[model samples]
Target: MIPFLSAWPPSPANPTLPADELHVWVASLNRSQTQLNQFWQHLSEDERARANRFYFDHDREHYIVARGLLRQLLGNYLQLPAHLIAFAYGEHGKPELAAEQATSGVRFNISHAQGVALLAFSRNREVGVDIEQVRPLDDGEQIAERFFSENEVAVFTAVPPEQKPQAFFNCWTRKEAFIKVIGEGLSCPLDSFDVTLKPGEPADLLQVKGSREAAARWRLENLEPANGYAGAVIAEGREWQLRTWQWPA
Candidate 1:
């Protein structure tokens, strides 16, 4: 039911949506040399350096493609050259455009797992997006017991055996996205909040400790980026509508 991004390679489409809408773009890093070069040319010098730091060539290329496309899309929205976009990191290492150079309260977050990446943008609200490849978990229950809130652990244990892998990632991505939205990274304990994980349940933030009312303030929307991966977006305000797209490589 999500609308994939209609834009293609070389040029990105400028997204125009209502004030309360959140736009999400997903892309695959499996690109040809030509596409890789296109993304690399748009990246800042620092981004290029970061790309080179990865130990594996595959990892290096993923970094380059992820960042290059990020800058390209941001530039399209801001009407600036992609390489010129400057970034500032939050206290917990979340990257954001430098306040002085950013306009219209434009904000974005990116997450890539395996070969897939998801990026989400919102005008004024804090936003976080995460994508994870659903894979086998050798000690799923043990991990859940250690990190999940008591109620979340209860829910996790209740799911039937066949659904554990998807359920585990569903919970993980939801928690990660919320932490990113709050700009707290690992500083915000994962067990402090609750998220829904059962297969048929809606993707949602169910509760928040200390800040008991926060669960209602943030909204979680489920995403299916590819066949075996799961993705989600968490935005501070519940009023926002979500539009998903498949960004061109």
Candidate 2:
């Protein structure tokens, strides 16, 4: 299990992110209206436009908090003001620092579920993070059949009934993290790769269907960001250390 450090200073400071270390920050999306107003200013015009596209106020608020916090966090690392930081997207819409900021060698990915969000950052390598609030699912098997590789489906089917929810999410998060890091999005089928999903089993990228040596190029680590949540982080290469931190630090 990964441990999250809650020792954050109230004011921003330059944090060292070594090339061989990965940082994952956990934050709560729920914020007071005042705090929301402050965070809203951190977003770019394009981001605010995207947030406005959300029909529901709850979703719009969450989007504001997530993107705002993301800018603040990246701002600390880049030593730049949050509002001036720009972003560029990949062919599949995976966001990354603009070329100007990319020179800093910071690569990142973000995911949020329920009221929590996870942001992962690494230097000189791709990184992705995912968090999901565990909940009962009536269609777990049906969804697994549609998305899981053959080996994954068989193992998932044999899990004890009571452990199914956790197992399902464990698999879901790990796979999502992998695809996001690869920047292929769903264009890379979830069923085209395999991951370890058994409760208590170590998180891993087991195989990539056509690439004999692909699985060895990345590493997966399980995360428990908060109660009732399952999270995972993946990054290129296995030589790095994971430093988990809470937001507001």
Best by lDDT: 2
With candidate 2 superimposed using the best TM-score fit, by how many Å does residue 141's alpha carbon deviate from the native? 0.7
Candidate with the greatest TM-score versus the true structure: 2
**lDDT per residue as tens, model 1, 1-249:** 223334312223566645688988888887888988988998877788888889999899888888988898788777789888899998889998897666658889999988888989888888999999889799989999988889889988989889999999999899989889999888888999989988768998988885658688888998887777888899987888887778654
Clashing pairs in 2: 8-249
lDDT of each: 0.84, 0.89
Residue 224 miss distance in model 2 (angstroms) = 0.6
Cα lDDT tens digits for candidate 2, 139-205? 9999999999999999999999999999999999999999999999889999999999998999999
Name the regions of candidate 1 deviating beyond 4 angstroms.
1-12, 210-212
- Could you estimate the TM-score for every candidate? 0.92, 0.93
